[model samples]
Target: MISGIGNIYADEALWRARLHGTRPTETLRRAEVAAILDGAREVMTQALGEGGTSFDALYVNVNGESGYFDRALYVYGREGLPCARCGSPIRREEFMNRSSFSCPRCQPVPRRARP
Candidate 1:
């Protein structure tokens, strides 16, 4: 997935929430989610900007299990499942192997810590 694209999507969603006069709590929740996506995108851009170190072949420790280097996109695919950040059912995965997990009720983006 395009990092910039994902960030943009998140930002747009937050903006929509705010413009719609969503509940204060819900608005804050959206903002937090945007932050998480933005932060993740920033991390990706910074790491890949060098264009030397490929995200592939990198090993990520998920639940203490070291998953092999596949692609940076995989990080977000795990949607609609239990968010590693919060124990909430995540949205369904949009792309393969890129499950997105977040308890919109618990792990709204901004509240999530940097992974």
Candidate 2:
């Protein structure tokens, strides 16, 4: 298990890894988990370099400056938009009173067994 990952980074990393957000963690292969962690590190590094993501004026750094990483995001908060890696549309779903964004083509949801 990992730590220090917020919702935005998690979604962005999942998108980069091409893994569905709703997939069971126990079903993930070692390589897949590695890829997810790698994606997370890559995006987090980029976000840190840019001072992090800020969608509104409420989020400001010690200097009272907003982050610019939000513009560079691939899927976070980009519902119904074209995926950066593909022409397919990005999808958003309501999760625990929050939103999760991903590329439907890149990250296909796994079928669940019927009760």
Choose the strongest candidate by TM-score. Answer: 2
Off-target runs (Cα >4 Å) in candidate 1 are 1-4, 7-41, 46-75, 93-102, 107-115
Q: How much does each candidate deviate from the true structure in C-alpha RMSD? A: 10.7, 4.4
TM-score of each: 0.31, 0.79
- Where is model 2 poorest over a 10-residue stretch in terms of lDDT? 54-63
lDDT score at residue 37, model 1, on the 0-100 scale: 55
Ten-residue region with minimum lDDT total, candidate 1: 14-23
- Candidate 2 structure lDDT: 0.76
Best by lDDT: 2
